[model samples]
Target: MAQDPPVSDLTDDQAALELQRLALVLSQANQAYHRDDSPSIDDASYDQLKRRNAQIEQRFPHLKRSDSPSDQVGAKPKEGFGKIRHRQPMLSLANAFEVQEVEDFVARLKKFLNLAPQSHMRMTAEPKIDGLSLSIRYEKGQLIHAVTRGDGETGEEVTANALTIADIPKTLSGAPDVLEVRGEVYMTHADFAALNATQEQAGQKPFSNPRNAAAGSLRQLDAQVTKARPLLFFAYAWGDLSEPLAPSQSEAVARLQALGFSTNPLFITCDTPEELVSHYGAVELARSDLGYDIDGMVYKVDDLALQARLGFRATTPRWAIAHKFPAELAWTELLGIDIQVGRTGALSPVARLNPVTVGGVVVSNATLHNEDYIAGRDSKGDSIRGGKDIRVGDWVQIYRAGDVIPKIADVDLSRRPVDSAPFDFAEKLKQEGIEGKRAPGDAVWRYCGDEPLADLAIEALKHFVSRQAFDIEGLGAKQIEQFYHRGWIRTPVDIFTLKSRFGPGQLQQLCNLDGWGEKSAQKLFDGIDAKRSIELHRLIFALGIRHVGEGAAKLLANRFVTWEALSEAMQSAAPGSAAAAALVEIEGVGEVMAQSVVEPFQDPERFAALQLLLAQLQVSPAPQIDSSTSPVAGKTVVFTGTLTQMTRAEAKARAETLGAKVSGSVSAKTDILVAGAGAGSKAKKATQLGIETLDEEGWIALIEGL
Candidate 1:
């Protein structure tokens, strides 16, 4: 296992590598769990990996893979089972490992709904069953079909196997014309133990866990084999309901129970985070006593209307979250430390440990963070781990939070080897032929060699055509690398001129190259030609500037509107100038990022290259915001002081949704200022500038109807 740096700590090249690694690793894990009914990693590790992957994608949205794990739900349905398309997609829940995260979840819900802190909001907390999710459809009060939650949108039709579960209702007295009941199919501990005993007596391989036993039995090809296995269902949610089940989630579960379907008895409603956390603790206490397996407690907004308003993200519902149990920890001997260099030339330290089982997965590698961490200090020289440095032969405690990789928690000084000495991190780097110097205020040691690395250039080219960038079809990473090595393409500018350079009757023509025919070469040319008229955001991101990812590029495009405007602004954004101020005033752009954006334009050589690149194609302006009914459309608004109606984030988001540009600072160009309680300098500046000023209530009233 490889240790990964925090998303915030990763460089652009490192983030790209991490995305690739996660895509492959998560794909394998999904196959093992959904297809084979034998998970390669525990649920905690899987959730952690998913969480990390999502964090990285959120940080570097441009580098997100086309086959990103964040977008996938489950593995494809296994063969031999009739395929069924789910009427509604069955999404997974975001996870919360700490009480603070649960609180944050509640806070986010209130913020999204623009509700007061003291407002009454109920949430239902129920056990997250550790088994396979199944959707059973009932049409006209009769059972129609039963489908597994395969890849969210489609599933395996296991109607015959599902009918054997006594907990599932075959007929309903007063059900809707179309009712799709979704729940978990699980096996009780007692039944699983008995089944395992039977399997041993019959010389068959016993199942690993109750959840695996249930999934394997439910997915069995032979209906008789499934009938003989003990499987139970608990209905907690619904899909494709012709009529609403109930106004609230708790009521909906009750409605399912009334329909003769088995439901969890401990499901309860709570009004606050305290109550929710209390219920989660109670559930954890009762986990061992419960007959079936449950990984954690799931919290969902009780009011169905609120849930609908909250809606969903790419893969998880914004109205719900799973409060997972704490990570498991184990002690293992620290074997050695290895330094791995990323494509960005950043050196990362990984800890090798004697294989030990934490939770259910074997862990041999952990992240040491950096040299400072090994010296028992943080970047600020603050003492950590009681100022006890880690040694090579010490017994270290490792914990698996989300299983992308385990992390070292603590060092066991008492069990440290007498012969072991403090690890020489600097000497190790020198020994590995790494002679890079760490920049001031930067933790990472980057390669500062005079010559440019081929890997960096190739990675930049790959990023230019990444899914969220130019997204050139047929011209992928492999093609880009091959062309780069052959000296056919050196930079992004060369890609646009490729067709003209090697279309036909030219020395070293693309059609004459191996793996390239007339049709294939023409297809590649067409793909390149299609990107001649590109979106402003895509073109900006395709430039591959540091700190300018998809989100940042979109922000830049939205602010400037057109490529010519941005180009002119960047060229004239001198130090302390209005243009420079405006550049930093854009929300999410800081001094460092602004400098990165301005550096290329400031250099004559780079600016000349950019000009040449722009000359080869047409750059479209940013997408128009449909703010026909917005009172603040095309206006620059600033919020200062204490907001009573909503948080600053909500206010900003609302303003943006209404087509208003929310700037961080007030300037001569400022159109309006929304002042709240304890209004500060920005409000004063707005008043001095003779700009429109509105109190919180006034601002709210202005946009209330819309």
Candidate 2:
């Protein structure tokens, strides 16, 4: 198999070097295992390395050279059948061997997008079969070709031999007009046993493992010989389309089954983390019950929209995450704690360790979570939770929690070092100077400082004057923080009055502060004066009530869209007033957030100060939302290329807000092609059939007119 290019950040030569190394590693292992039957490395080791290579390729996208081996599939089709190209390029996933890695991956995913930590992820789980990869193509709802995954880019045609498998379709019923189905072809333990029994009676070579047996069977020179074996195809994924098919990932799998495809029924939808674990457990418990071979179960995010947002890494898609079943175990030491701070200041303790292999990965860390989680104490002290009890420097038995994370299963307390003691997280926090801002949840420390309110106010003010709101330059988070710390500002009102104290003439007084320079102070005053007039909705939101974040702020402001209207509404709804409850009825405002908004007005002193600040400010309201801007503005559009009108991301976000849906690999459902420069496969596909395609200029023109 060809290696994938390293991610874009890597130097071209560096990417090439990594690609060559990956190719050599995988090629050696492949030949040793498939041809010589003398494996150079175990499956876990091979899988882990491959996953690592895939990850590196995904991150440095600019390094993606067309010649990368990752573009090719490993299997060739048998000589008899005609081959069809996959509608969607089949990419593999980058993986993790431990909970910390998986959690870290999740955290990184969110951090890159500036999302909340507790933000829910939609994921799905399925069994990862240790079998030959196969793709089936259908057009006009008729069987076209069955091909092996050659290099992901090209494969040998194997339609004739694949046709012999009963589970596969020669012609599928209820299939969409055009479809490409992907799945694994495998020989089950029972099927392989029976086949091998027949082979033994005939004095032929029996296979070693089901994977080997299936691969050997599918690649046979004689179609008749392969026909004699009972091989099954369990469809997991497919792409290329004539029309839109399923709405969600789970729905798509279900539809695949309805189309005469032998899809795995173990695929289920789960909403919560605990529910997800239960679903994973159910699959694990039934590992032997299933007739076909599944080396591990795969969990993917359930939401297609979220999946689309997370898009594909070179090897795998972000929308979905995998949870593989346990395969092996490794022993390691829980060296010490490395606490990671989260965006919301949650403290999560990670174990620092001497790296050791478990499940083919050399895991050096695992989650310790919180102080309550250490010393065999849970948040509620119930058996220390997760059946995990281990201390720093203790010998720990680690196993793949579904081949996803290296979970500590046991601790040899007898092997604990003499220096080992109950880890005092408090002492560690004090040393780190993070004890004051202890994480809100389980044993964690934060840097909350002496005045949490001032810290929070600074965060709020930063948002208030942000580009999207007031567009105030020189009044960024740093200035807000500095002002709050220096006692120059307390609430949003203090900002409007600041120019009076630190005038252009008195800017000499402003200079000499750690970050302030004469030029910077003058720029700050100019910015403050320039933003003397802001949108009314933004002006109302600058007060920074407890629960009024961006979404809430927008909703509250838009409901009235001006400070005068908003204040009047608040006064009308004060306490038991019907007007206040009416304000609560606005979408997105719960009773708690609504109460927080209205109750702030009840504070006469605070309200009076806020009003005084407002008196000095000149603000106007936005024209109006015009309701058509709500996602699905009652129109449809398609997009392709390096969208000059906006980033493909920005265009898609706008489309979604206007109630438009984006599809990968265009189809008949596609409406308007907001094609940007350098449009490729999509524009080609759209044009061959006379599908309307727009150039960047045309898209810009259309949107401008809209």
Candidate 3:
């Protein structure tokens, strides 16, 4: 048995003796496993040691330490993206890795909050998206900007690209004017697959995994690049708001939803950790069917007031915890190896496997990662149990780092016989993406070769016309998918032809089918026509490019002035490669967005067809700016309280058209302060400073003429 670390409490002699008894053994074993990529025992045996350490500490509870190796986080934070200064510091959660850990987490919360064991404390469990953290800012129902978690103090601005996420609401229903919402920006399995396929086709390197994809999407310098990537979000936190929020965590989320923020749907209120874990299991099973990737479950205490009282640690909050799922691990046959290039232009190896289910989803391949991962071994220099020079028929174990790509874990040596020959990856590519549809040079990692691709195409079309994409009210995703599958529609134009495509005879046949009707079909066509007069920005956005988002499209439209100008700029093959070079030369157009923009235009047939479709619609030049000579022009203003003179809507509308940035809070940066009856926080904040404050009459006088 390895020696155990001593408790932190007094009785130095005993403590030192205990640490000495276990120091070298425990540290060596841990180093071998975590750092050196070697394991002294199987997972079960390793768990036994940890359990023993836990038992010893339990007997000496006072000696328990926070910095114990048992409680450390995996991998340090990566260096990139600027930091963000959160109004409240974003913190890491204490974990509930296993069922027992979950029970303990609940027990600790109950004890800390002075509750009965069976007390009905409402808790919420949300999927912990295994991706980058982002904060989105909105003013008057319109998206203004977005940022990364950068240092948790200041993040790089990437709003132009954030507009591309299909699921994120571009125009939140009843959106608050001053809203700062935080969410995890992630990539879906389908998006990742398509993106990697394109990358492979162009001989560009793919992402290491989906988490990296999400990170890359949010960290782009140009919003357009961010827009082109198929990123997704689920609001989990909030910053400054126009109004105070509900008392409970669940209610706050509900309030967010009421204000048009997209919150994750899997959130639940639980009284105990067991129930929390039950929810976790339910969600884990559903991951295979969900739109984005998630690795753990987040549990938050319900009461906001209680949460404030509990407050936060420097890095994480005391009111919440993250319970990680059982990591994905499976043993399968290592049939061969293949090499793949990455976005960063690095080469990697992928393990091809006999299809096997890991964590309930069928995985037929695993990432070999860098050359080091394939060639390196653990302490004692033993071969990595899984596939260090794996033979053609060797059985290997694969583990997903989070819930994304599969990686080699270890091998079952006892099952291996001496007759197997070493596997070669380069040769596997000649056979891959054929029946299985694995692409060439995809040796470092492979996706499901036999995944029903037809269904994916349908899914893609559904994504294209989704609410965020085109906001075509009448057509639903399932309907689009069905239409595509039935060969009724092929392009965006096909969506317009749905009603015309289905003849009355076919319509009558469809009416006999479920969820189909003459009225519904007619409504769909009307909806399609209603969107015919698409705006310049929205039309550019609906094309479903990888990262060309609404904000970027808007910027591009504004800069280029017209569809012909923009299209002409994109199509020019002038010296310095006018179109491509110009795109890449644009301040925000980095390699990724430049490539994405260039590729779509590169297809002459598709470009010609798109241009023809665009020619049909009456695209707006820009939103009509209301004529205003209002008093608040060029000033930053925040509105508070009920307005008696003018309606709140009237005041905001008048203020917006006058070219003012209407903010939410009474920050030091605020210039003009408009106070009304029943004003509270804003009034107090205004009073703290000698900034000129206006009552209802004064405010009325300022905007009376305009």
Worst 10 residues of 3 by lDDT: 72-81
Top candidate, metric lDDT: 1
Runs in model 2 with CA error above 4 Å?
1-22, 30-41, 51-83, 108-115, 326-706
lDDT of 3 by residue, 1-706 (tens): 3332334432433432243223333544544433322344433344444555555466665655554434432222234434344554444466556788777777777888898988877788899876777778777878877766654555556666677777666766665667788888777777888887765433244665566677766666666877778877778887777865677889888887776667888888987777888899998877756766666789998988878777776556778888776666667888777655332223356788999756434689887764335554443446564435555577888775334567777766677768865443434444544222234433233334444345445554665565556777656655665666668766777776567667777778756556557776667678788878777767776776656765566555555656766777776734367566766654334666656665556688778768667765777775434435546778887877656445554465456656677777888888877765346667777878766777655666776655
| Every model's TM-score | 0.50, 0.42, 0.44
For each candidate, the alpha-carbon lDDT, in order, equals 0.84, 0.65, 0.64
Residue 481 lDDT (model 1): 76
lDDT string for model 2 (561-672, tens) is: 6777777777667666788678766655778787878765677976897678778788787445343645335545667655422455445544554455655567776666
In the order shown, the candidates' Cα RMSDs to the true structure are 15.7, 25.5, 21.2
Once superposed on the true structure, which residue ranges of model 3 sit more than 4 Å away at CA?
1-84, 173-177, 289-291, 331-352, 356-362, 366-397, 402-706
Greater lDDT among 1 and 2 belongs to: 1
Candidate 2 residue 216 Cα shift, in angstroms, is 2.0
> Could you tell me how far off, in angstroms, the CA of residue 261 lies in candidate 2 after the best superposition?
2.2
RMSD to native, candidate 2? 25.5
C-alpha RMSD (angstroms) for model 3: 21.2
